[model samples]
Target: MPFYDYECAECGVFTALRPMAASAEPCDCPDCGTSAPRVILRTPNFALMEPGMRAAHATNERSTVSPKSTQAGHGPGCSCCSAKPSSRTLTRPDGSKAFPTARPWMVSH
Candidate 1:
């Protein structure tokens, strides 16, 4: 089901609803009981790439100095290792540290 955005003219209310494509054009406002105009909203579409396509895309799009590249460059059991302390600390936008306890993908390779 596709979600549609609508705006009520009478009550000046905006909302999103899952409705059929044909019925979305002239949907009524759920709150004010008035006819609302359906608006097209921006939605993200995600597609899964095959392993070969993913590898090719990664090779093309990834920079030479990415974190993964850095991790691979440092030999096994280094600070860049997923099991090390460096990987456990996640930095915030404001330069704060977030201590991650769960080692989801952390393993000494």
Candidate 2:
């Protein structure tokens, strides 16, 4: 059984354990007994994809390499979060932004 969230406008939010097939069905509010619709909530996912878990495992294995290097933005392959080492970041002129560049592969956040 999976725990699901149900919200009643007249009452409040409540949780109930039910089967996956009944997840979409309305649940009775414990307080007012009114029908409450199920609400979607984010839950932790224990299952990992093939290459995804392997990469995370490899990174965890390197935790013993260096104490300071393990810090985020300073470790190898952390260039995405690390600074460019430049004295100052370039400023965008005018009201235009450089983001979502003209590249076809890039997307706006």
Candidate 3:
């Protein structure tokens, strides 16, 4: 059984647990016994759920809607996956390498 919202003429709004088949049918208000039509007041009651349970449900829903893509591509010029080395060492015309800011003992690879 799922909870559904109903708007009574006398009362503002009320919730009732009813079968899915009777979801569209008007429900008798619990307070004044007036037949009220079903209405959508809000989304599912996830706030009332436990923190861990709510996280699990969110993960499940996210996976169902959009699974993480494993084959995302990076461009050749992109720094993260580029073949070029990003070393800050400067190369002189004499073929010697100069490490301006690097530690003296740090050897270039």
Candidate 4:
């Protein structure tokens, strides 16, 4: 059985479950019992994104440097890209730091 949508003059809109062969047949409005003709409806388009994927997409959108901007050297004394992306001055305590590569003490390589 396939679901069908119908419009009734006195009852607005209603749904019905019917065979494909009888999908085009008239439907009775549940409230008014009036015979109403079936109507064609457009299917809905939906996107289901995982939490991590959605978060990553949002982060990418809000990135400080865009592909075009970074390629043209948006920062001072830099073009295309630099060996270093961010600089850190550790006057305060912050765990977030960037190095070109991990040191021997940081990880065994």
Best by TM-score: 3
Q: lDDT of all predictions, in order shown?
A: 0.64, 0.76, 0.89, 0.71
User: What is candidate 3's lDDT per residue for 1-109, written digit by digit as tens?
Assistant: 9999999999879999999999999999999998999999798889989999999999999999977754357544567755686788799999998887899898876
The local distance difference test score of model 2 is: 0.76
For model 1, residues 1-104, the per-residue Cα lDDT tens digits are 65667777777646555557555467777787777877656543324557787776667667554645445457656754467444766778998866577565
> Model 2, poorest ten-residue lDDT window?
87-96
Global lDDT of model 1: 0.64
- CA deviation > 4 Å runs, candidate 3: 1-3, 17-21, 72-109
lDDT of 4: 0.71
**TM-score for model 3?**
0.45
Q: If ranked by TM-score, best first, what sequence of candidates would result?
A: 3, 2, 4, 1
What are the candidates' C-alpha RMSDs? 20.4, 18.4, 8.2, 12.5
- Which of the predicted structures, 2 or 3, would earn the higher TM-score when compared with the native? 3
Cα deviation at 46, candidate 4, in Å, is: 8.3
TM-score of 4: 0.39
State the TM-score for model 1. Answer: 0.33
Best by lDDT: 3
C-alpha TM-score for every candidate: 0.33, 0.40, 0.45, 0.39
